[model samples]
Target: MEINQFLDATYLKTASQANLTEEETQQKVIELVKEAILYDYKLVMIRAIHIPLVKKILNEAKSNVLIGTVIGFHEGTYTTEEKLKEAKAAIVLGADELDFVVNYTAFKKGDLDLVRNEIIKGIKLCLDNNKVVKWILEVAALTNEEIIVISRLIKQIVFEDFGEENAKNVFVKSSTGFFKTKNNLPNGATLEVMKIISENAKPLKIKAAGGVRDYETALKMITLGVDRIGTSSSEEIIKREKNRNKGY
Candidate 1:
């Protein structure tokens, strides 16, 4: 398979997170968009604020690389209403997909209603606007059992309420690439975590985000049932693929 088709070229770091000035961060985003246009990757995953900029550039270049953004971001602590508001604004700004961080903390606390309600509302907003939606589970923060349950929860809600036909646009994404785990453990998609999510969230697509730095790991994640890969290293991965094809 063509790796670029399965890649979501991502750059979601904030200025503080990368220790760069706001202008520098914006320049990086501009460069990312140019790369996406040049490579023709499936989508450019970025911050909502960058959506308008990306849209402008992609349009100017007449490129079809999609625009994806996050809601409730690295932390799923925001209220459902707040997330919805953010999502609505993103759609208005021309985002093609919305990756929402599921409130897994509430799910772990056994507040099923809070978690379920947010998924329902957030997904409905995306579907209504004809935009793709992904639910980020932040796998490192949850136990294996929690991962299975949450993935199943998203699947059940989508299939039962939103109808199966819409499943193509709904993805159960793994990670925000920002969670700080103890001992510097992998804070992204792992094979074990992805297996649990894949077996349970089927029908709904899977996006493996975070820690996917090289071509080999990205291929393995796709082989293990990841429908899309969210990574900041798209250029390197593509370069490695080219080198391997030439027997480098």
Candidate 2:
């Protein structure tokens, strides 16, 4: 597949407090949106909290990408019910899809069924409310085996709820940015998780977030079948990629 095709889809992922004001955050998001359009990039995983100010950003796109948001983001402690509510609210505000954090600790504690059920519930809620879902496994917090299990179960659970064809919209993603962890596992975890997801979650979309910085890395993940990227490093990556293409 072409690297540009993967660039067609990505997330601005403004998970920060420094740019919190509605005006300031909207300015940042709009600038990213326009940057994507200018570079021929197409879908964006925008933030839910900033949805109210998304209109101008969405309108500014000449080759506008689709808008997405995160659920149980930054933390996976929220109940599946909370994720469902947030997803509904996001859908009402025009979210094309949602990136949900899976309760990995709960799964590690042997509540595997509960984790799967919760994800299925969230996806059901989104579909019932007319939206799509991207389930984040947060690989930084999971073992490689657990990652495989979660990726496998996500595909199974989504199909069980929404049927095979509709399951196409259900994605598995890495939200490894919760906190800086020891041993540097979370740092390059997206690549490893993408390998497992690409191998196990056949035909399912995979999103890579946290720790992505340059074009080569982005291109590598996309080649491994990552459908979208979540990054705060868009400016640096785009410019560097452009310069590389120009042989600079």
Candidate 3:
């Protein structure tokens, strides 16, 4: 299959959720997701607890795409146990993929084992749900060398935790919409993870988020081995795609 065919959209509908009521947010999500599918874009749900409700919407729309939820999102403060609970709960409610935030505090402590174990727990929880797990490394928090180390640690976790299934499910990501170091995302970090993704995450997927504002940046990532693009800018991106099509 063409990798382009495998490219998909992950919608971070946080502002929509905060700005609108649950029902309103969900209605808009359904409309956007249906539109994405019409454009042959695979849908990856981010944030918003209304995802399960949209699962039926996808089915009705005849869209065969993934429904994802963020686990311990935005910040990596959630403990290993909390992450496991969140993952299981999300899966029980129809989440097909779990994008788990890595335990940054543990990583900061140099507690590599704790980091790996937490990741393993998340992987197992997703597996139990008969689903896939994507580990968002939040690479903007890590230095260049740190990205490589984290990538290697992820490789080891995949090798030890759940074998090929987990590896296939795993994704290395640039940011989770918020950054501890930078107020906004850095393209250098985005390209840093792309470099790691190209060199390390061969079978694994790469999702680039944080400051992806236009079609050019998004397309550059897709061409560079990124499998998924997470953005709240989906509407703008699609409009750009359409304008490019119209050549106006």
In order, candidate lDDTs are: 0.93, 0.72, 0.71
Model 2 misplaced stretches (Cα beyond 4 Å) = 1-5, 8-16, 19-23, 60-63
Over all chains combined, what TM-score does candidate 1 have? 0.98
Q: Which ten residues in a row have the lowest lDDT in candidate 3?
A: 1-10
lDDT of 3 by residue, 1-248 (tens): 22223334665556544687767766667776776666656655655476766777788878787777788886887988888888778777888878888886678779988898887777777776678677777776776777778877777778776786556677777677666564644732366567775577656667777777777777777878877777766666777777887896
Error of 2 at 2 (Å): 6.1
Between prediction 2 and prediction 3, which has the larger TM-score?
A: 2
Residue by residue across 1-248, what tens digits does model 2's lDDT show? 33444552344445365547666767777676677666655466667766655545666543455677778876676887887788788888888778888887798898977787788788878777777677777787778898888888888776666788875777788774655579765553367678998888867777787788778888888778788777766666677777888889
- Where is the poorest 10-residue window by lDDT in model 2? 1-10
Model 2 / residue 194 / CA error / Å:
1.3
Best by lDDT: 1
Error of 2 at 47 (Å): 2.5
Lowest summed lDDT across 10 adjacent residues in model 1 is found at: 1-10
Q: Which candidate has the highest TM-score of all? A: 1
> What's the count of clashing pairs in each model shown?
0, 2, 0
